[model samples]
Target: MLSKLLIGVGAAALCATATISLADTSDKRIALSNNYAGNSWRQAMLASWEKVTGAAVADGTVAEAPAFTTAENQVTEQAAQIQNMILEGYDAIVINAASPDALNGAVKQACDAGIVVVSFDGIVTEPCAYRIAVDFHAMGKVEVEYLATRLDGGDLLEIRGLAGVFVDDEISAGIHEGVAENPQFKIVGSVHGDWAQDVAQKAVAGILPSLPEISAVVTQGGDGYGAAQAFAAAGRPTPLIVMGNRYDEMLWWKEQKDANGYETMSVSIAPGVGTLAFWVAQMILDGKEVPQDLTVPFLTITQDTLEDSLAATQPGGVANVEYSLEDAMAVVSGG
Candidate 1:
């Protein structure tokens, strides 16, 4: 009988110092079930999956590892996609889900069908599915903690991610928690950036007229530069805006640093964590007794590393690191 496995993971950097022998099952097939692909971050994620899994398929690591994404970022659409992947008889399905609880029913069905289901980023809450989750709460809190060292206290403008998503909720909660603890900073205005530059710009522009002087802007990702743009266009002085790891954001920081000695940090996970999910599925299919969950860490770029990160990043791409099978095994070994 197949053993039911569930794992709870903490946020840590990916470790790959340990090596392990593998079991063989090269005939297995895997599939990626992604919810949305609207923003550059999602676009970069899809590209990473294709590059890594395409190589896996070419090298015969798996028979097929096709990816599917939904046009609308809806739970119903993604559930239907999962059902179809099940009907198609895929051996494993890795998800960047739309909902944590809303997709649990479909996830259960997939697990009951004996398919190895691994979720990352937007993870599911089903007991049978394995999660490779990020410490997004810590991420949000860290942004504030970093800011506390720089400023005494002032009004903050908050830029949120997609509304009603788990990541948005968790990160926002952490930010709020940090604010509560610090008590020095007050959020005077808030808007949903939808994790897009144009959206953030418009939202910030709409709210800027009524708020107090913002000492800083807090963001989810893909919104920092837009926030900066809104401030410039409004003739408001620039504020310390936290950045996501998008290339454009870093590039703008480098430009500002050169012109004004601006200093800030960038925090985000690479889109390449999907590749780690791919290897987890492959290891499971190979009959390796791997751990159920993986800890996905966030990447932070300080002022000193901004130029190097910008150089490493493609014009429209985000800072990224693709994991190898060895990295996956190290995660399994708890290294």
Candidate 2:
């Protein structure tokens, strides 16, 4: 099994409780080669990198760590970004990749250049690159599992993330797997929301006219509130819409919960998985014997945990949690 790394509780606890001695990497530098930044989660991810890596730099853990994203969420665009990182001569490159395997050549180039490469969230399948992976397939499957408890069988609307991104495919596939296991529910419509609120709102609104009564709107994050908005605007009754951990979505869930005992679950990888990637890259440069593949649990907010999570989250930010040197050491030693 891949080791589970529990760095900290959330952003509020990002303050390092303990520190480990840095390996011979104080002079090294790392760069984040991101593929896209079009949504709240992506924006918060960049912010987390800056927040954690900024402190790491100030403390001389690494000489530098900067994030760069592409204007277009495409394979060639991200491949070019990876190539640029290789040319700049960074000691390590942390990636939220555009494709699972398409950028293997560019990542291999970095590995051949003796540069450490770490991919997270939208991870690459390149064997040479270390991965801080998420169980996105399980993330999707559990959404339907959650719905099954509240909903027996009904028509559904599926709002997916960016088209062609491997994350989207995995999550959607898991949702379908859940439906197959249950056999009571059926998906009536599917659309690409690109993991954006406005895009999701418009897409859901457009499709609501055609879809049969949606019992639950399954999503790939950043689309729950928009789905709710579309239902309200269209004068259709709200369904059990699952949420990604965005502030607005949680807030809307909160309002609905208070007004009536409306209930659903929110789940997503905390955006600070970026900070975990940063520390993992630093650990590799620190000469820690780390596995190439590892997994982190997604944050799930349920009826009972909603208030606490909502309190911990920053306004307009994700419920993120950063990692520390000690946390990385635990992963390295399998503690």
Candidate 3:
């Protein structure tokens, strides 16, 4: 059941139509508040949120806003934004927490003020509200296991995301657990990519010479692109295996493979995550009871599964049975 719910939420993130009308203004106000807006994927998510949920807003509408991506990637301003929403008496609040524990106090305050609160992507500790998130642990383990089967015995390098972020921690934990079980694979070093492509690329460029024998590389987010660029620049064999998070990066990998005849994998799970986050907020706003933790099932796309473009166009970016939004509302309302 938890899996099903996560799937439902994931589907919402991947496919959303942006024709919602905001003609209605009532007491049932909702806020779509986000932590960071700097990345391409995050921008895409904001667009989807406005598009898919806009249609039903004639009687009530959600106010969309964002917090800047600070030098520390902090959400202090975002927390204050929620406090303002509470003072304004918004009916519900939907958030993507920048830090796991830091948002707990603010979330508790919003909940105390009678606002329905929920989180997405990164969730807070003790879970003051429900969450919609991808299974980072599962994602890390699955990707690493794939790399292990392909590389046999070799040196590996990892480019990770924002330091101390829960998603980063979850993926790292999963990778460590998977790697610990395998003796042939040794992780030589890891540099914080901060989920940025350029940061990852720079990190890899500096580390490549020092670890020339590296055979496999796995990255948490945008840094995957950097790893590929480093391999290209160094004129080295593409890591026997590599995996990354966004679909566009997969497209780049496909291009690299086609042009150079080098194989790579893209295990993208971002689009569906937006869907999951949005629905989780909706469910909570409607007063539905959701599981404390849920993992959206994903696929590790290689050359073979790369041609399913049309199917990939569907909601969640992974094919699945379509569920009606009415059902979600029904579940939330306990009708």
Candidate 4:
């Protein structure tokens, strides 16, 4: 019988060093269901899945691992896809959900069918489904705090993630929390980047002529480099821009540092965590006991650690590190 574990929203920080061994098992059919594929981060995430799952298939740990991407960013569409996966008799489904609450019913159906359902990045709220993610609230707060120190409580431009998504709301709330503590840091303007570089560049460029001088920019991932490009194109002095964990953005930060001693940090969810979720589902299919909710820490890349992150990542990808079975287990166990 399958177990249901409802982890509290305020669970303790995950231990980043706990380890778990992968169980030897026969081939199991796995399906990856993703909501959006419009950004580099999502692209890198899918790439990681392909690479890791390909290796798993070679080792006989997986029978089949096919991925599906939603054309539109619609919850209804994603729900239909999940329903199809359930009808198709998938052994397990790993989802990057479109909405937290929208997919609960479909996820429950998958769980009831004895199909392991695991959601990450953009998560679902179904109690039966396991969720693997970082503390988005903490991620938001930390980025703003870093900006606050550099700006000394000055005006900031907030480049937000997708509107009305779980991660977006949590990160926005965290940014407000940081601003509450630092009254000197005022938000001069806010806009949605939808977590895409081109989208962010267009949005920021359109608004540049109208807004007053800004001291800093706080952005969700996939758009920091775009925002920087916007500032440069507008002939405005680029303020301190806090970066996300995209490869191009980190590369830009490194170049600036080398040329002018520029310093900033990149804080965001790692795209490679998709691989961790894949391993977790395999563990569950292997009948290994795992947590209902596993929290992975944000990939925090500083100037000192940026080069290593860059080295681990590929060109046109996000700066990410893959987690082995042991590393993923440690994140869930918080050991």
Candidate 5:
């Protein structure tokens, strides 16, 4: 009777362990490579990711597998890291590729090695895996339309992000589409800000004296703040219409509004990209089918839309609306 009881107890224990293992695949680890942590949006995104997945890391309780931040914004570094992940036999890889095409070879290598790769935020035009992104073209066109309504026929200074990026290219195309529809709006000067605050400030400062006819500035969110600083320094009396930048720097925008009397607009792209990346990772781990393209909704936030806009910013400062693993799974399955 005692021997029979011992055997039964051992069998139950083994079954429970196996069931727990099957429920959460946290043991299936993944690596995340962000394009760079060079801005407020990226920082906010990193914090959000930690908040969502930190508990699992702390308790070593991955319902799926391990996920970690492996590299930041270097194309070469990303390639090396992906190679390492392949060697380590990770189940999935989530990357925010710095360049649209530069990471293609590395991505192909990952696929060749039978590892799952999903790129988000920025895309690799070459199809090695899944892609999740914001509709940058729509974002740009929407922003330009807003600017067009604010101005009739004024000289506009445009601030651009990194050159040759898909986001930049697509957004530029959208802006052109909007601008072409309104011929009265003239582009006085267009400068590359590289999406950096200091870079934008310097770029706009240099152009201000030469193109003083600037009626309003159209630019990336980061460049929007820089344009405001430039306008203040140059004593330019023009309003700025921009995409999401200075997300946590609302005080700065309010101060600028009071002092410079210029208005700004932005879309929360970071959270969208983060949530998408997490979903792609989940799909890869589940051995599920992933769509070639996944686009998240982008919201425009202005002083008028402040209340609605603030509602979307996650409590942890994440850019997108908060969602769970289950929600992400739903999206993956549906897509």
Candidate 6:
């Protein structure tokens, strides 16, 4: 009787161990759904996602992380792609939405199907989905405020971002707020850079001939370098250009500061914020509690920190950094 009882206990212990092992080794399939792939920032964001998800695959934390990009900036197409992901049975989906409100229904469908959904950068308005974003309004206010300190009220040219994007609109509104408060600073004109270098250069080049003498240029990211290039090509002294955090822009600004004491500042949404969303999804899969909304602060690169930013950047890439899983958890837990 004693021997039989011992065998029963041992068998129960073995079953418990096997169950735990199976749970540990279970695969989590993740998918990244991006809206547009036109700009370097978007490319860098994709790179960040690839790096993190690749590591997860190696460690058996992720089963798959297939990335998909839309050729055009259309919400309907993105929604359809997401619906396909639902049918394909993705464990999690990270999105850089094309529109804030347009993807709500699809995102809701994903949530209903028991898939974890997280949005960043160009975020979605689906309340059921998790969001990790920087405060763009604050970013805009700060960018304009930094330029205001130097210009002390002058003809500031505003280079807006992609039309109809929530981030672009919020930042523009914040800039207008800053301009309104600082009565000395006046926005003489505005143009759409579409947050691309060549595009911004062409747009600025076209408008420079018609606009009055500008004292400063306030630009969204991916356009600062091009705007400077346009001014240089036009044989005009470049105004105090507040830049976004791009590697090429940082390199240019650093060289200018070294050569001519050209002073400026840069701030933008970090490409690695995508990685933050990746880790957030991983945590949720691991049965860790995370918030519905989380905020990662924007990376602010000034002259003093430019060298460090450059050193941290990958060669031929933008200034980017990824947060570790522990670091992400800290942000989520308010730690």
lDDT of 3: 0.63
**lDDT (Cα, tens digit) per residue for candidate 5, span 1-335:** 34533543554465466644322345656667666776556776666666665654556544443334435567888778767777876666777777888888888877776666777776677686888767778777776688777767777778888998767887777777878887787777899988776898899899888885676677765666677677779887756657453444344565666776657667546554565576567544544445777776565567776545455554324335544667666666765
Off by over 4 Å in 1: 1-21, 70-89, 98-106, 162-166, 206-212, 286-295, 329-335
- Residue pairs clashing in model 4 are 15-334, 18-330, 153-184
TM-score of candidate 5 against the unseen true structure: 0.70
- lDDT: worst 10-residue window of model 2: 1-10
lDDT against the true structure, per candidate, is 0.87, 0.86, 0.63, 0.84, 0.66, 0.85
- Model 5 regions lying over 4 Å from their true place: 1-28, 34-42, 55-77, 98-114, 125-128, 149-153, 162-169, 209-213, 247-249, 256-263, 284-289, 304-335
Local error of candidate 4 at residue 307 (angstroms): 2.5
What TM-score goes with each of the models? 0.79, 0.76, 0.69, 0.77, 0.70, 0.77
Candidate 1, residue 5: Cα displacement in angstroms equals 14
Between prediction 1 and prediction 4, which has the larger TM-score?
1
Best by lDDT: 1
The digit string of per-residue lDDT tens for model 1 on 74-182 reads 9999999999999998889999999999999999999888888999888899988888888889889989998999999999999999999878998899889999999
RMSD for all candidates, in order, please. 5.7, 7.7, 9.2, 6.1, 8.3, 7.4
Give me the overall lDDT of model 6: 0.85
Rank by lDDT, descending?
1, 2, 6, 4, 5, 3
What lDDT does candidate 5 reach at residue 291?
76
| Candidate 4, residue 294: how far the Cα is off, in Å | 2.7
Residue pairs whose backbone atoms clash in candidate 2:
none
